[model samples]
Target: MKSSVDQIRERFDNDVERFSNLETGQSATIDAPLCLELVAEAAAAATPEARALLDIGCGAGNYTLKLLEQFKQADATLIDLSRPMLDRAVKRVSAATAGRVEAIQADIRGAELDEQRFDVAVAAAVLHHLRSDEQWSTVFAKVFASLKPGGSFWVADLVAHQHPGVQSAMWHRYGCYLADLRDAAYRDAVFSYVEKEDSPVPVMTIVDHLRAAGFVGIEILHKHNCFAALGAVRPITGG
Candidate 1:
């Protein structure tokens, strides 16, 4: 029998196909190139030889494609809970990477990954959907388990604030401003999705989670508004 994570992944796969085709404004700009720049920077800093990379939640293959371009020698595995998203990504990266990029439709929370290890693991804009602290802990533990010694994990996500009033107000204003410029469908889908799952956790909590999961050398590499990039490394043997 498939696990709960597997069931969630099946649901997510269906939703992502709808989400990807909905003409949502956020889907267009809030993707790989912009997000992976931060991740690549963090990965490079953590290890000089990032020859193998794994991208968790690799929707539409954007970050995986960008990583291949930036790190020519790197082989990437792009895993997502969404089949349609993985299908799209596989098509996009297959040519340039000569099938060096593999896209898998599996939940990072519990699905079995390939036995081969990676120099870096990246998850961008994915943690918020986990819905619980224990889920987050489980996900981080799995990510930690997948890495090679000295390998790093890079994450970029929305950071929850202690005083959410100001940030909430700003997000409302920003949504309104964007609504005025974009089509109604675009605005509605993007804004509605963001608002529905706006329950973010503190950035420090994420850092702490990584540390508790046996990661070391943690650092925040980038920040823009509520979105931030943080990373940590697996310890070298006996150290």
Candidate 2:
């Protein structure tokens, strides 16, 4: 029997054809190169060369392609709930990494990673689909375990505003942004889809989950209205 999570995964799978188009993903922080630029700025010092990366909810290969482009020889493991999405990501990264890339079709909520180790783990615009905070915490813990000690982790996603006024403002602004980008009917449909299928938390709550998962030196790399990019490292001493 299909679970609720499965239904959400299926919906994302249905969008696979349009998923690869970068423009469809535009938002406050969805720009492909801009996201890595934020990561580079946050890192300041360069990360180790040829290091491995774990990409959670990779979708149709947007972030993976950019990461490989920026970090030559970096290996990547891409995980997503939808196989169709994973297939696209696999083809996208296979040539770039030359056998260094692995793609897995698995849901983050319960998926267990293998012997692969990663220097950094990142997810883009993906976590809001998780049904609850518990699932989010689980994803963090799993990513923490997957990384080598002292490894980095980052995420770019939509965040829910906590205060009533702030939430109202963000929602209205996002609606306006969508309307400007697309049409009014499209904006309304997008809003409805978000309300029904997504569960976004405030940015601090994400940091709290990362801390609970044993990450240190947490950084809020970027936030624009309701979208944000946050990153941190697992303690080398395994704190």
Which residue ranges in model 2 land beyond 4 Å of their true spot?
1-3, 22-33, 40-46
Candidate with maximal TM-score: 2
Clashes of 1: 0
Q: Please tell me which predicted candidate would have the highest lDDT against the true structure.
A: 2
Tell me the spans in candidate 1 whose CA falls farther than 4 Å from its real position: 1-34, 114-116, 180-188, 197-199
Candidate 1: clashing pairs of residues: none
Query: Which 10-residue span in candidate 1 carries the lowest summed lDDT?
Result: 19-28
User: How close to the true structure is residue 10 of candidate 1, measured as C-alpha lDDT?
Assistant: 61
List the RMSD of every prediction in angstroms. Answer: 4.5, 2.7
* Cα error of candidate 1 at position 95, Å: 1.7
Tens-digit lDDT track for model 1 on 42-123? 6777777878888888776656665676667577888887787788767766755753777777667666764328888888
